[model samples]
Target: MASKNLENFLALMAKVKGMDPTSDASLDIMQDYVTPDMEFVQPPSFPHGGVHGGRDGWRHMAKTLNENWQLHISPDHMWDIPEEDVVVLYVNMEWTAQKTGRTVHYPTMELLRFKDGRIARAEIFPQDTHAVLETLNAHD
Candidate 1:
């Protein structure tokens, strides 16, 4: 059986997968599954890279990423570490540059920590950060 934390994580991902990143609805969805003190980490190579603290910071990062690229993420696998209250998710992601129409396809491994059944920390590790940066910097 899947842990409650993993189920909540999957539910959250499903809610946000196709939603507008900057929309109020998206924020509401985030609030449902994430703690107010949530921390999100992205690769420095990304335009919106860095460690984002709190829900507001996460909102900023999501909005910035959406503005720069159209992202499609499909979860490939997920494992729950019940002892540590963490869920590890592997996803296949495709980012299409809005300006240049270039696309970068990569896999990402994410570590999510839960607090009171809500996501409190998330760290993303992309398989090919260089390719992602190249696609983002590409011109038509």
Candidate 2:
């Protein structure tokens, strides 16, 4: 059986999927799955600022990403490391640029921190970043 935390996490993940990547997903359900003062981060050399703090920051980042490129993430696995207040999700990302018609797929890992049943922080690492961007930019 899945732990209650895991179950809740899955439910939250579902909400994220229903969210339109082109819009404000974080704002739509922030109260349910995100803590106040949450942080969002992408690893070094990320196109966006390395880190953005709070809900507003997340929204801005998401909007920017959507405006620049199309993204799809397929979840493969998730682990609740409650002892560390972290959840790690394995996924594959497929990106297609609306402008160029180029596409690429890559494995990715999303590391998130949860607090009080909400997300506090997140980080995404995609293995084939060059391929992803090339495809996305091609359409542009």
Number of the top lDDT candidate: 1
1-140 per-residue lDDT for model 2 (tens digits): 55445666788767777555446654576547777687888654545547878877777777777765677778898887877877889987777766686877878998988776677888888887677667655332
lDDT of 2 at 134: 76
Q: Candidate 2 overall Cα lDDT vs. reference?
A: 0.72
Model 2: what TM-score? 0.83
Which residue ranges in model 1 land beyond 4 Å of their true spot? 20-24
- The TM-score of candidate 1 is 0.90
C-alpha lDDT (0 to 100) for residue 110 of candidate 2: 86
> Candidates' lDDT values, in order?
0.86, 0.72
lDDT of 1 by residue, 49-75 (tens): 999999889999888888888778788
**Model 1 alpha-carbon miss at residue 67, Å:** 1.8
**Model 1's lDDT to the true fold?**
0.86
Error of 1 at 57 (Å): 0.5
